[model samples]
Target: MKPVYITRTCQIANDQLVMDGVEAVLDYKEIIADPALRRRMSRIVKMGVACGLKCIEGLTPESIDAIITATGFGCLADTEKFIESIVANSERLLNPTPFIQSTFNTIGGQIALLRGIHSYNVTYAHRGLSFESALIDAAMQVNEGKKNVLLGAIDEITASSADIQRRLGMTREYELGEGANFFVLNATASGNKSAAVLDIDTRSGRLTDDKLIEWIVETANRNGIEISDLCIVANCNTATTDNIKKRLSLKNKPLQFKTCDYPTLSARALDFAINNSTANKTLIISDYQHINHSLILLGRG
Candidate 1:
């Protein structure tokens, strides 16, 4: 695999951890840079474009070869608006604007238009693995010879969707979170201090405790990463996290961030780990459910 470096990272979270408390909603005014354009765009679209712009602040948009996005729940506010419009108008009259912006690919489309980017654009909505899938695709594109890839993971939670998911027993961890995170990746190293993505692997299927160890060990071995050399950032069951820690005898315990089941935050942890530590290597382990797992290895050079 071609080596890729995470040259830039930007995160726009609804609840960014502040000294006193979390910032409930991100202020897009500074990010958008134009009041009229910001007013015309939806919340998710604004967040997406803002995060993408921040990630590639110095780089030219024309240099980007692909724009990839991942969102488990895409444009939730617009989706709810479209549904409410149908009910309010007795299914006869409807607002076409909401309906037009309520798709999974809307974020990617909006970003492309805003940047005048006509490169390869794609969005992945694979529930739990959405962000991981987007990263995988971007890394593949870089390895396939794309110069630069703008990858983003965005998810927003509206009250309606939050309540529905709550009834379905999905929001047990904490209050719903919404955020957009963007990363600019290139095959070549940016500088001596650049953070490099060593490997990214995902597994889906049932695995016993022993099988889990084998899977983890195999991935580490494949990447030639010693377990002792890793700082794991994971959001998994306590038992699973403990088991991995015990099996590997990892020097650094797994790092769990604030949000659970939020892929963008998980991706953000990669950025945090790289920036906050002097360690040469770190790993991100994600498994909201026990069955499927995504592991990302990040190394600094």
Candidate 2:
């Protein structure tokens, strides 16, 4: 597959805006100008729409060939609102805004509508594999001669959702969290960083440590990178990282990317790799609930 260079990175989390690894001032009022529209958007909507808009700030809508987004729980607050409204109003004269905003493609649709972009737009919601799937699609878009593909992943945590996940044992390793991250993919190298998506693969159900290690090595070898040369960004637990280091006989200690309950945190891990990794090849190993697993290989373009 052809390399897809990440030309720009934007993230909005914890009331902060990070662009291209640099922290900048964030004002939603500036990003979403209309006061009335801003009032109606939920937290997730604001975060996603703002992060995406910030991602393509200078580029014209015509240059953006695609808008691809991923989320595990799309617009939960809006979903709850719509459901509650159905119950409250006895399913009569229901407000359409919440229902409309609760769809999986809300963010992507909102971005396209705001920018007047009439290109390919899609959203993925495959649990922990959501971001990886979106990324795979973005890479394919770039390979097919598409330029400036805006890819984003966002998932917001709600009170009810957090309680439910805790009851389901999803919060054993890390607390529930949420954020938004966006990237612009191009076929050619961008700036001095030279970060590009080398490869991405996802798996469902239980994945053993040995199998995970084997996948990592296979991905490295397939990309012409030696196990010794790959700098691993462990998005899984510490025990898993330790096992990988010991079994692979790696020279460098794997950099542990702290995990959270957010299904799309791997997107943040990808951003961390692009900004923090100095190695020629970086591999991010991510696992969620020991049921979903993924390997993302990134390297210089």
Candidate 3:
């Protein structure tokens, strides 16, 4: 299999969006401050466009083949507001814009419209695997001869949703935050610095410790790799780390980062692995509950 090249990448956090000391393409606070739903939707569309534009170095808008997005909680603030309005006013005279924007595919549609990309646009919202699904889709498209693709993920941590997840024990103890991460991918290799996604696998059931080790070994073997070739292994939780160590007999030492942040902040691990220098490859293992949700292999081209 050929490696898909990453043209550029950008990230926006709740606190601020900065790239090498420059302000981000969109300001989160400014967008949230808008009271009107229509205006807020417009702001989101603009932000998506700005992110796409910023990620594509010198390329123009016409260069993009498609726009794809993955958002775990799509327009959560709008959803919460709509629900609150229904409750406060006894479900009478409810606005429609919030309801419209609350759909999971709204960001993708808005991005397509802004970029005039009539090509294969899609949005995936599969919990923790949301962004990974989008990445896989983008890579497949690139491998199928598409020139350039814009892939992104965005999730908002609204107050009410945070409270609900807290009660359900699905969120972290700290305050919920919002962020966006975007990337541009192409088929042609470039001299620019980028991470190559080798393989992505997803499973639905709980994996036994031995089964998890077997899965990793098989995946690596298929790609002509050995256990010692991996420089790092990133897992979703400490339990996952221990499971890999015990089952795989890996003693290279793993780095685990767990804080009172977003529960799905495992995506941050991907970001960390990509930025850091490693010997050969980095294996990213993400498990949800007892289910082995996703495994991604990443390396340089």
Candidate 4:
């Protein structure tokens, strides 16, 4: 298979959402303050379009082939409000707006509706692996010969979801936040860019320290590269996977690994990999543990 080129990428965080390397056009906190569902949806779609425009300047909406999104908790604040309204109103005369905006695919649908894109539309909700799944699907679509694909990952933190995460021992002890990350992919260069996508793969199961290291090494070997060639490693900051750090140290490959400080900060790693990439390659490996789930691989295309 040929390499899949990344045309552009964008991110929306609490204080900032960047397109390519530039700051986003809108602030996430300001958008969340809007009470109306339709207004919120419109704001999100607008921000997406703005970012898309910045990434692929002068590209028309008609050129996009598909829209795919990965959301860990879609419209979480609305979902919580709807549930609260049910309890507050004794399950009577409930407002439908919250429920309507709470669907997982709402963002993707809004984007398509605004852009008039009618091709492959998909939304994945696999906890932390949500973004990875969306990225995998986007790559597959491009590999299948789609010229351009719009891909994004969004997650909003609400008090209710944070409470659940606390009970499940997934969130940190302090506050919770929200954010979105979007990207565009193409089979051929959208313009004159020449980035290469080396390879990507994921695994799910009980993997030991030795097994994880071997898997990563084998994955790199498949692409005709070695751990030594790896300049950086991006991973999630989860205590359960301390062994991964130890194994990397053992390899002594003189590589740098950045552990996302914020839960959604993994997108920051994506930005780093794209901006700071050198020698035509970079590897992004996300290891998520949910009932023994994991996502591992190298990305360069």
Candidate 5:
């Protein structure tokens, strides 16, 4: 299949989650130009829409063929608030605003409405692989002859969600954070300025070191490159990194972005790789629960 190009990108990460070498969190504007609608939507919705608008800057909204979003915990802040109201008011006469905006697909729906775009819109909620799933769908759409696709990942941490994450052992070494990262993808480069996504692969369940190494080798060979020619970027701790490197006998250390929460981990790693001009060929690896992994290969064509 022909590679899809990333024409534009807009990333909004939690301030503390951003890597030291990368740009800081995006300064998102609270108001969305429409006063009436601005008063109804939640922060997450506005944030996602802002990133979406930025991604499609200088382009017509009608040019977009689809809008896909992935969120681990969607509208968590509003969810918590709505739950609190339900508990306080005996689940009667509660404000519908919170409940309406708390859906996992709200971001995609809101973007579609705001832009008057009536195209294919979808959302994915596949835990750690949510963003990867959305990316996969967008790529598939492009492969199927769709011209332009808009996709993103939005996840936020609330007091309720934070406590749950702690109990689930998801915040052991990484700090809880939030983000809304958006991108515009096309079948070909818009004006010879886009980055090509060579391939993407995601795995679930148990995986051995040999199998992991083999997958990397096969993917690199398919792209006409060697392991040494690609820079590995992963969201992993020192121990995990050491295990992978020692097992694969890798000399080039992978760029680690393990300090943030799940939703922004892989997105931030990709942001770093794209922004770093010195990196020629980049490979992104997201290791979830030390078992399931998602790998992506990107380069300039």
Candidate 6:
């Protein structure tokens, strides 16, 4: 696959907005003009829509060729409401709003509806690999001659969802957190801090430490990058990263990027590497719930 350039980035998390590695005012009214419509949107929807709009603010609708989004738990609040309504009303006379907005494509659909972008639009709802799947599609779109591909990932924490996940033992290492991340990808671009997605690989089930080491070396070797020279951004845990470094005999320690766990946290890791990594090439190693794993190689293009 061809390398897709990350031209712009925007994120909203912990009640803060960052664009292109710079802190900015997060005024939703400024991004979403219609007051009534804004009032109707859920937290996740507003966050995703606002972050995505801010990402493609300067670009025209004609310039945007596609809108792709990913989410692990799609619209938790609205889905909960819809389900609760169903249960309370005895399966009758339910409010249509929550059910209407509970789909996984809401973010991408809203962005396209607001921007009048009549191009390819899609969404991915894979467990922990949601963002990576969306990213792979976006890169393929760019390689297929698309421009200004708007790709985003969003997940919001709700009280009910958090309790259920805890019962399911998902919070053993990290608590449930929520954030929205948007990136603009294209085939060609020139600017400062220029970066591109060089390669990506994903796997399921259990991955051993030694197997992970072999995967890392193979990814680097195939890309013509030395394992020692690549700066590793750990999106899993400090202990795992430290072990990988020790076994590989890497001189530079891996940078810790994961504090809390989320399905789309790898998107944040990519954003961090794009802005903070000083190395010419960076590798993001992500381990999600010891079940889903992925490696994304980023390079300065």
**lDDT agreement of model 5 with the native:** 0.75
Show model 1 residue runs off by greater than 4 Å: 15-27, 33-36, 191-193, 205-209
**TM-score between model 6 and native:** 0.98
lDDT of 1 by residue, 67-170 (tens): 99988778888888888889989998677878888888987887788778899999998776788899889999999989779888888777788788789777
Model 6 regions more than 4 Å off = none
Weakest 10 consecutive residues of candidate 3 by summed lDDT: 29-38
Could you tell me every candidate's TM-score relative to the true structure?
A: 0.88, 0.98, 0.82, 0.80, 0.89, 0.98
- Candidate 4's TM-score reads 0.80
Which lDDT value does model 3 have at 94? Answer: 90
lDDT of 5 at 269: 64
What pairs collide in candidate 5? none
The clash tally of candidate 3 reads: 0
User: In candidate 6, where is summed lDDT lowest over 10 consecutive residues?
Assistant: 244-253
Native-vs-model 3 lDDT?
A: 0.66
Q: Alpha carbon lDDT of residue 119, candidate 3?
A: 78
- Report the Cα lDDT for candidate 4: 0.60
Each prediction's whole-model lDDT (CA): 0.74, 0.92, 0.66, 0.60, 0.75, 0.92
Residues 203-292 of candidate 6: C-alpha lDDT, one tens digit per residue: 999998889889999999999987888899999877788788788856566899999988998988898999888898899999989899
Off by over 4 Å in 2: none
